[model samples]
Target: MRVALGDFLELNLRVRSADDARLQTIFGFWPAFLVAFALRLVGLFKFPFLDEEDRMMRVAVNGLFGYGPQSGQAPFWENLLFRTPLSNSQAITPLWWWTEYVARLVVKDETLSARLPALLTGLIGLALFYWLARQLFPFPIPALLAWLLAVHDVFLWVGTKAQYVESFIFALSVLIAWALLVAQGKWRPFVVAVLASTTAMGFFLLKGMTLTFNALAVGVAQTALLRGGGRRLNFETIVQRAIFAGLIVTPLAVWLLAAQAYITAHYQVRVAELGYFRGIADILYALTFGYGTGRTASLV
Candidate 1:
């Protein structure tokens, strides 16, 4: 009897499989994607123009054509000196300039050109949120959390508008945290930490006061990790750890220094203006339950 060729091929291809695990992962993502898509669609019609949205639009417009609110010379000495350093200084990341330019090339209309980047950035933010959540938690929980975030009205609202750096900062912070957690004292994690920190620092430059909160959060997380059961620190150990931390954080430190230099040379503006209030009620409202213009509903 001759062995069939197909039989041998099938035997060779057969291996230990996690088909069930794969299926669960695929199914898990469906509900979250659907909910996020629906929320974003609804937001397009419900709130087309928000205050920060206008600011983002202005920034994009100024960035693209080198025109708009920052166009004319101002009377305030600080505005005259600090803001005028760059002809169209709008306190935006240089990355936005490239994004704005691409938008202008694609769409001739100023309003559409301005709003396009925010829409794109919002989508990126949502995707990053899901990616980060998945890295932190097991299957359904992360997916479920992502779904909750997806339909969140305020996030959806902010996603549609421009000038809000929280979404971007939040996403970068998540990536940095994930990289730090998974890093085995490797170069890749160090590189990622540096890049993520630099990007987050852009938000700080755009609005200076994020520095304190960001610094505190990073410090607490690092201290917790260092102290948490795995490692012991002596004088030599402490010095080594300090050196490692410094290497990881140097990029952010440099960016902060540059931003501070810029601010100091030109303005007497209070850094406190960079901080904003989001009351406990607002946090509870946004995270635990969703709030609309006039009503609130449970996220679950």
Candidate 2:
């Protein structure tokens, strides 16, 4: 997404030179990201898969390797977004299965292949975490905070796992928030607006309910804090914002409509991720207690 990259670059460009120059120091932003990514990769394939991982792996294997209508599993591209080979309860979490399936193509080890998505996404998230933190915080604080989060049991244990969507969600949430902050400025860079809306769209597609809460909270905060801090909102501004929002939401909404119809016709039992809420809770718990953020064997 050129728009997304532009927003990220503009984030740095918007910052003053003194602040930007601080990012080039010894304990700079990229170094923090690299260190954090390395730490998160510690148990990439060491610990056993969580129950969630097992569930996704099943769907992933069936989708990638299964053949025939009698096999009872839908192919990922055509008929499968939510349904799993084992049960309908498995269908609710669609993104991970697709990702795991792709990873399974080159990786023969079913379990490890399935886990690649989380590991890779988690690494990317670590990098983005630093950039977003830098956008919001000053200098080494972003670097320091990134290091702390790297070691945080909150992220180490559950957030980095393949089956969980929270790491991706969390990173995307930050991107959305950053974009909003940038768009709220009087300058209103088109790329930033698109990025904010696009990120919002992606987050919603991943989990609509979860994204709803997060978007509302972040949207309100950004609006109140940044909006109108520079220039007054006019009709044109309102129209522009509405158009951008429409662009962000309309495509996803259409996709969901088609998806819902397909799901209803194909797999009638509307199971909304048996582990979806629990997985979310696990992430929250990790954030709170710093447990399950890393290997069960080590809290360090």
Candidate 3:
């Protein structure tokens, strides 16, 4: 039995472990690692300005000791507790809020407190991308391509910003994509994708327009996956999956809708102030690695 098993292993190895395969895998993964390392090093030196960082900090501080500038009628801490039920609240998720609060206990300085969590999250994002890419493109080239795309300048710029939503969105996007691609019809991967989606939704709630594009991208991906392989679109299967997905999404969606309604009701202003900063033409540039370009234009 041992000899037979050894023979089988040898045959399988001979078939799969070709020199070309090994080279491709190695080449694919190396660039991603180099890019991630470079970005992390750069992040340590220069802190980029993130508009949402202050709001996240406020939420964290409010969650910790319960005082916030936007608190009305109720104490900020009490608001955090109540806001948990609503989709988009002034409150951070309890776990993340506590983590920030704990970090604050050590760091003390507000700026450092905000930046450290984001930096660490960015590192986690990098590692996750590597793992996911390796899994998705087992040979390495595809994995490297995906990783390079994931860590493009726009993503890196966003990742470096303290408390920015883009880092989380990018991380969760990679994770969910990998999970969907590799899940063997298992509940665990689905659950993980759901959680990652929830986190991505949080980014959407936080940044609104910037993350909305990501949400739409994920939806398109999901549709493509469902439609792939000419799989029969059975109503029962579709409904079942929808129900399950909805279950997973309920908390986050409820929170988002609630927050939007609350903000609309109170402020009488749209929660998301939308404008084309770089213009529609710039999107072509952005799609073709034009984000970091210096060209500036206004809407006609």
Candidate 4:
């Protein structure tokens, strides 16, 4: 979200000559992104919905369009606090459903309404990926990498799909990592510290388990900073870092505790649901054979 146009241009200026930057912008970034956008547009209109997408759209319709009690018109307080729609499993998130719902409300075209979020977020993620690459790599390498990812068939496919708004979470993860690692100011770290905490909660709202992994990765990175470069940590510095860690973790902790209560209440309701393993045997099979089958399909 902090990827300002000025900052992007400034970073490019720092790394390359103005003419080179202009050439890369003209011949590298814009062309690649435009091609990528066009390809995803093709998929959005031409490709048939897959089974997973059909299921996701079904859930979205049930929540957003269904009448009677199935309608998504919850009280604002309940909508804010309850985890009724946000699942622990890998189904579409409530946020995604609401996004499509709002799109439908605005546009009245089911296909466009359903698929627009993926296309938009996918474009955002692609842009962020390019920016992050520029930060790490020099000159044309970043542009080349962006071009490759733009034409990647899998990425294009996912970009156009309705159920694959993982792009949103991916963009958020990229932004969070970029902010925490590349920030250069006194108050900026503190601001990022607080925003990172809220972002974890936002991740939880978007997808289960991603919040935990993202928080752990950021925590480990910060911990590395504490012990990095042979700098001895004084007691006061240690205390300040501890407080900083606390500030970054408290929001996520509160959300997780609240979510646990809701999950416990709903435990009985999830029995034998699709994608819910029944026993240790099912889990073991999934860990070994099930995922391999997907890889095999990909290779095919």
> Which of the numbered candidates is closest to the native, going by highest lDDT?
4
Estimate the lDDT of model 4: 0.61
As a TM-score, model 3 comes out at: 0.58
RMSD of each predicted structure: 9.4, 10.1, 8.3, 8.1
- lDDT value for model 1: 0.52
Point out the worst 10-residue segment of candidate 4 by lDDT. 291-300
Report how far off residue 166 is in candidate 2 (Å).
0.8
Residue 209 lDDT, candidate 3, scale 0-100: 31
Task: Score each candidate by Cα lDDT.
Answer: 0.52, 0.55, 0.55, 0.61
Clash pairs detected, candidate 3: 66-77, 86-255, 87-255, 87-256, 88-255
User: Which runs of model 1 end up more than 4 angstroms from their true locations?
Assistant: 1-21, 41-46, 63-69, 72-102, 105-109, 206-300
1 versus 4: better TM-score goes to? 4
Question: Each model's TM-score?
Answer: 0.59, 0.66, 0.58, 0.68
Sort the predicted structures by TM-score, highest score first. Answer: 4, 2, 1, 3
lDDT of 3 by residue, 1-300 (tens): 999999999989877857646565466555666667577657745665455656656454555554565445455554454332122222223334545566687887776665666666776777677666556555655565657654777666655555444566667777776765776345677667767767665544333333445545765576677679666556675577669878877876675456455544554321111212222222323323422345332111
Comparing candidate 2 with candidate 3, which one achieves the higher TM-score?
Answer: 2
lDDT of 2 by residue, 54-84 (tens): 6545544554566533244444454444344
The 10 consecutive residues of candidate 3 with the worst lDDT sum are 269-278
* Most accurate candidate by TM-score: 4
Tell me the lDDT of model 1 at 1: 22
